[model samples]
Target: MPAVRLSDVAQDAGVSLATASRVLNGSTRVPGKAVAEKVEASALKLGYVPNAQAQALARSRSGLIGLVVHDIVDPYFATIAREVQQQVFASQSQVLFTQTDREIDTEIRALRSLIAQQVDALVLVGSHRYGNDSDAALTALLEGFARNGGRVVGMGQSLGVGRTIVPDNAAAAHELATALIVGGHRRFAVVQGIAGIPSAGDRTGGFIAALTEAGIEPELSIEVGLTRDGGHVLAQQIQEHLAAAPDDPVGESLPLCVFAPADVMALGALGELRRLGIDVPGQVAVAGFGGVPDADDANPTLTTIALPLHEMARQAVDWVLEQPDEGSAIGPEGSEGGAAHEAADTSPEGSAEETPSEVHVRGDVLLRESTALAASD
Candidate 1:
């Protein structure tokens, strides 16, 4: 069978080829209601699919959104990706998704591919910075994309590029730590996420700040991947700490509060601990960030800073799809911002403006059984 073309639709609709193109190809020049209805009906009957490139050319819009995430398998990013995909589809657009696996080169490659595809906008989730030369190529690609009038939405404050939605990671962690302290948790350990990723740093940094304020220092600050594998490594460290004081059974009287900045990592650590026959909140209490659904389902429910992952991802979609009248070029210089994406002021002192290029979101702390301080028998 031959592919159905514009000519076929036009012939079936008893309209000109140009009229069928205008009606089905998303040309800005819409035909009259009756003509459009006729063209659409004929195309539907004929099973004709409009060429995406042709539609893009007709409307000066691609109807495509590029979403680049660190790891789609990570529930945090998975939730965001799911929300973004749904929202974009609702807007009659499609999402072009790519995963970076937390590697800079992979992310750079993904960005290059998306740019080449000429996606109308982009939503970048959970890419963190190492604050060095590794950032150069990534920065260049983002800058060039924005310069070329492509809209970009940043899910976290990685390099502060693009119109950003920042979660109050530090404050949320601070509050969670303070809550644990009030609950009589003394000995503490923080399993940090990938070094240099802003989300990991902010969350772990926030937790440490609370300890510092209480004149309490953590017994351990271990750095690891923000993934489950990182949690496996964390469980080993916990075992070492327990061995140092095996006399107390590592519970109640000497329980350790192990905090992982991301829920995936925390869940990872929890699973490993259970595998090692170490009881949670009995021997060790655990908490994590992002509040992924799996946290609630863990053997011992996990504690976490429950961020509005779905809503935040929605905001990223809304920003990218809505797009400013003239998108502000993304960089340290900031863009011409008369349109606002509202949130807390994390920007510098003199950088205040009537409408901001960035938005801030806060998370809620949930203390679950995973972090309960149960007394020993």
Candidate 2:
């Protein structure tokens, strides 16, 4: 059978083709209530599907947003993706996603494809490696995209060219380290993630600066990929370092506190340590940044900086949608749109109305048992 078209719906509803097209293609010049209802009912009866290109042409809006992330399975990105979807849906649109595996070339290709699809806006998440120079190609693409009327939003980091939600990663890590030192932690080690990735680098740098300011130096430093498997490698390195050390006369040494710049890495190290029969907090203490959900569920509860990930996601959604004051949210039917949210810090004079405003939000340091957090809050 032939596919039902707009002309067919028009004939069936006794309306002109132009009127049917206007009604079905999302044109702003809508007809009167009765005629619109008739055309809609007729289109439904005839199973006429409107062409996406035609609808976009008529409305000048595609109602689609592009979301780019490194890995959807990563809990951190996963949380942001979920929130972006809900917020996009609430605005009566759809989300198109692409994962680039943290590869620059792959990211370029994925974004080009999204532009071809004519997404109305973009939400870019994950690391912003080696500013301007390395990102030149991606930046050009984004600038062109913006010129074509599509909005750009950067979540979790600053992307120089677009509106951004920046987290105070370095500051938070510095505070966490200071607190641990005040709690009498002396011997220290650092496990760093990918060198150029901004977030991990900031955390490691901040933690080290705090120790240096307190007149102490980390005894060991290891760099690895920002992954759980990397954390396992960290555990082996720790084991080797401890094995080569001298023990005190009483056959015991001060506990070594190790800091992994990410929660996933810390949890991985913690698990591997237990597997190696190492007693946590007795011989060694571990801490991590980014308070991922799994951190609290870890055996001894991982100490971390609880970042406002949900708030960051929402702010990105709001900027891309240009609806900071629009409070509705999409959820399961019968659920209210209003729910209490984690507080976010916005630039005092910046509003979503601004084209390229930057909002900065900070995380709270939660010292848990992984660092042998005391009962005091």
Q: Which candidate should be chosen as best, given lDDT against the real structure? A: 1
Q: What is the Cα-based lDDT of residue 58 in candidate 2? A: 76
Off by over 4 Å in 2: 131-133, 246-254, 323-355, 373-377
Instruction: Compute the lDDT for candidate 2.
Output: 0.78
List candidate 1 stretches off by more than 4 Å.
247-252, 323-356, 375-377
Q: Model 1 over residues 48-113: C-alpha lDDT tens digits?
A: 999988887776678888898888788998989999999999999999999988788778888877
lDDT of 2 by residue, 1-377 (tens): 99998899999999999999899997889999999999999999988899987887776678888899987866778888999999999987899999987888888899888877878788899775555464898877776666455667787667765567777888998999999999878888997657558888888889999999999889889987677887899988989888998452223356789999878789889999999888887777999877788887998889889888887888778666653344323211111111011112321122222245566778998988888833434
lDDT of each: 0.79, 0.78
lDDT of 1: 0.79
Clashing pairs in 2: none
TM-score of 1: 0.87
TM-score quality measure for candidate 2: 0.84
**Residue 242 in model 1: lDDT:** 81
**lDDT: worst 10-residue window of model 1:** 336-345
